[model samples]
Target: MKTGRRLTSYALNYKKIILVALFLLTISVGTDLAGPFIAKNIIDQHILGIESVWNETTNGKSTAEYQGEFYKKEKNFSDNEEKGKEIRILQVGTKFVFMDEKLEFDGKRTFEQGILTVQKGDEKVNYNAKVLTNKELMAFYKLEIPGIIKLLIVYFGLLVISAIFQYGQKFLLQKSANRIIQKMREDVFGQIQRLPIQYFDNLPAGKVVARITNDTEAIRELYVTVLAQFFTSAIYITGIYAALFILDVKLAAICLLLLPILYGWIILYRKFASKYNRVIRSRNSDINATINESICGMSIIQAFRREKETETEFEKLNTEHFTYQNKLLSLNALTSHNLVGVLRNLVFVAFIWYFGGLSLNPASVISLGVLYAFVDYINRLFNPVQGIVNQLANLESALVAGERVFSLMDEQGEKVSTKRIERFCGNVTFDHVSFGYKEGEYVLNDINFEAKQGQTVALVGHTGSGKSSIMNLLFRFYDCQKGKIFIDGMDIINIPRQTVRNHMGIVLQDPYLFTGTIVSNVSLGDPSISREMVEKALKDVGVDRVFKNLENGYDEPVIEKGSTLSSGQRQLISFARALAFNPAILILDEATSSIDTETEAVIQEAMDVLKKGRTTFIIAHRLSTIRNADQILVLDRGKIVERGSHEELMLLKGKYYQMYELQKGNASLAG
Candidate 1:
């Protein structure tokens, strides 16, 4: 997967760490092997021996006639005593009892057989009898202190090495993952900023956020878990298998059989995981889209009482996400169950076969101790294999995430400007510029216009009549498909996008205010500008008094999008922001619509001061707002049908005059 490769590249720098981890892991496995080896030594030396012999004895005779008889009645004490004393309770292969010899009893009536009887007259003398019976073949026992000490040392050293390796691996892996996440976030955000406006026109902001945040996180998971685990697990499996083979070829053969079976299972699960994870990711994006819309339009929902409908839609998306998650989980469980079951049964079979073989060959000289150790090794052999198989699904998911992130990164950005424009003036022109969102349906058809320095041009058109499209063209948010737009007698197409945007100032209907002090928000227009300059601009916009009311006037904090302030206040701040830059040209996009009449009157003065000595384009619905323009162009269906002063259009009694009269009548009625 694309994302997988991208994330793996991050680990390239940590190759040395990975190698060290591998070395330490090998040492650890070797130390672990010593455990079974030590166990085998203890068993063979202490529990069994080749040169040992055993002798057993009986104190009474066996009653063959009594065995045929059931429990004949114990008629008297004498008969019972005789029966007990004559019967030999100890038999062949019976366990030996260890105690003092004084505890021995005679075969007759439980009388003491041999005891330290102190005779008064005859002094006690040492009397012994030597007797030989059956000698059974047995093993000798010996304990090695030096070997035990060596085993302990190995265990301690292994602990230290394993700890260091584990800690180091986590540290390096985390650092790598953080760096990759940072890069992914940067790239996704940067791409969004450079993408053309049309790309965002029909898309939801929340979906974009999901990609930048959630999708990128998914990709990060690949680096942190899937990518790293895949590498380490595979290496561990190989190393373990190699060690096992070197230790015992027969046992290793039994263990190696698990490899192909494990690989097949991984392959099967990966296919299903890829399909399900992709669906989960896509649906998560959709859910995010719904959430973004719901939150952003909360006011509208509240006003319309459509909360239930919105919640229903959200639940639908959530359900799909859950469905995808459950399906993937079920597949994962099935894969694990089958793989583990097979490995477990195979391991048991291997142990039985190996041990049975050793038992059958009495002269083979393979000790029971060795067989026990081999059995333990067989289990250890497949642990790393199982680890690799378990992480296979994670690897697949990471691959899917990687592919998505890479696909986004690989998408085409805005066309690059080869021919750079070095100089520019305020002379702007749209020469036969035509453009459309879709083919054969132009939003602006053969549009032509010009604005010289120190001229204010007013575009008067109904909604969708292409007034805003003209502004969009001037800003080069999109290039005109048909014709060229020029700035200062130079084609805008040749000028870099940054150069064009840097020279233009714009105020939209909904002014954006970032989370910061009021002064900072205004000063964002020119970060290098001083706080004093920002205050001066705010004063010029006649918002100085409002700032004075706050505890910290110029430093008054503004919430996101200026939610804490009124519409007029936000517009005034925006006006000051645009003025702070002192751009060569400015465009107002329905900037006065949200402001109240009283605030509009106040900002009108600020607008007048800011508009001087620069070319400006004004788009407004109120005729009174643009009556003072040097020229008014009325557009209809993307065509410029009328151009004149306000009075001149009124005298002609055309479309502009009719709209003006209607608006004037509505104003009078409302008043």
Candidate 2:
């Protein structure tokens, strides 16, 4: 799906609220656009109506008294009223003149010596006119006061209604935008969980963090600001065009030229802006990744005295990010206000030409009210135009961010299954198993092994000898490319990964702890594990002896990675966590390599007791640690070269015997 369509789908999730908001927006635009028309009515019908012809009348209402005669505007005269000779009241410059005889033609007027000369083209006519005093002019204007005041009240009322609806639409639109972003973040995070571990091996944690946070935030602005401006501008522009056409079709047709010009500019601007914005967003992700890597390896960098080098590397990424941002800024500066200003100027030029050459002629009947409304609507038209132009940058940014977000969502991921199964007796087997992280390259050769129920098997190997790889296959982190792995004689590949992992647990050489209390980390907030169960697991793993000095005991807070705790403390908590889950199969991957001797003894004692009815696989480099194993497999180059109990291997004087003797010599030399 297109990024725009995907974003629209998210919006549709809350279509009810969004549709209601759009309805309010339309009403708001309608009420606001009514202003110019109402002003036109006030100017033409009520204020300028006095200039029209008046007739002598006997009607008492709506009459202006002059020279002992009561006269009413021709428009105000009712049917069946007594009629008298028509007279005119016209403005000659700043002063009002009364003419008892109506002129044959009306044009540009000049008044002097009590005569008004009206000229149109080659025709000229004169009327004997009387200039009214301020008091007499007041009588003519007084008749319009009530009507003008009523229209003014209506105009203000419409403004109030417009404001109310405007506020409603903005509030509702923003609310729905927040809700959409909330759901999007949830989906993105859930997708991350469903993704395989290999995905994280390629993408840095910070880039993933940026996707969930920074990218989604940009999308939020898309819904709240960019779309809001676009919608409002669309409605406002449409309303203004309708009003313009009503006032004068010719001028409105001229104004229509702006639409295509604006559309073309948008297409052109996006062409350049999209390229710059993509680089900017990509660099932003790079900067995040760099910062995360720096923080995580700060100790290593400082210990090696590479701080200056690290700073230089980070500055390089930051400089690239800054350069692209400036480019985007320049693009915006060149286009936004400048484009709107140019368009505004062009429309105004057309406006002045239209009214100057065609509408302002003496023979033209176009009223001053129509001219005022036209200018008003033209000026109003640019507001929405400017709004749209200003928001173009945000629009592009949102689209790019949405594309990134949806791409992450598009990655192939396994569906997490919640189906539970009864715990099976641990009888794990690898039958002619072969696997590789990359295609056509086998990391583990065809391997065969069987670990019966409740048996403990120890794997001794150097790094890159496929020890951890074997455990990875068993846990279904990655499936074997050839052969099969089974538990209780059922092919593991046939089971859902989550369901298979349900009865398995592992502890790593470097244990990972979350940000929570020790008890919470042990139980992992699982409802099935009670506080008593957590305490019992901690006790079984000798965690209480190590953590007894702490103030909160098992409830003591553990910060990120358990950074505040000792390595031994973290490992013990990890052990407790595994014990709490009570997995049927447990793999300890070099679990004791980093521990001090005393802590190692504590873990060994706990392991001796805990290994009772569970199949345990231990990957170890310390030859002394697995001496009593029921079976010991010594692997080299992804193949098992030797296998037996420790004493049997010692008697054979083989590869295992050589490894044990080498470790013993190292220990004797250190002593």
Scored by CA lDDT, what does every candidate get?
0.70, 0.91
What local lDDT score does residue 227 receive in model 2, on the 0 to 100 scale?
A: 97
lDDT of 1 at 111: 14
**lDDT winner:** 2
Q: Model 1: clashing residue pairs?
A: 3-402, 3-403, 49-139, 49-140
RMSD of each: 12.7, 1.4
Candidate 2 at residue 426, lDDT? 95
Give per-residue CA lDDT, model 1, range 1-671, as digits (tens).
44545666755656676566556555555555566666676565434422112212122221112212311112222332433321122211233211112313211121123322322223332212222122311111112344456656776776677667666666676666777689778877888776788888877887788788877777677667765666566655676566567657877787777778877877778778889989888888788888888887999999999999999998988998899899988887776656787788878887788766765553444666777777776666556666676776677666776676666667668644444334345788889989887878899988888888878899998889999989988998887889999888889787778778776788898999999988889888465788788878888989964445778777888988999888888988988888777778889988888888878888787778777888888999988899889889899998898988888998999999999999999999999
Task: Output the TM-score of candidate 1.
Answer: 0.83
Residue-level lDDT tens digits of model 2 in 149-241: 999999999999999999999999999999999999999999998998888888999899989999999999999999999999999999999
Q: Kindly give the stretch of ten consecutive residues in candidate 2 with the minimal lDDT sum.
A: 355-364
- Candidate no. 2 TM-score: 0.98
Worst 10 residues of 1 by lDDT: 134-143
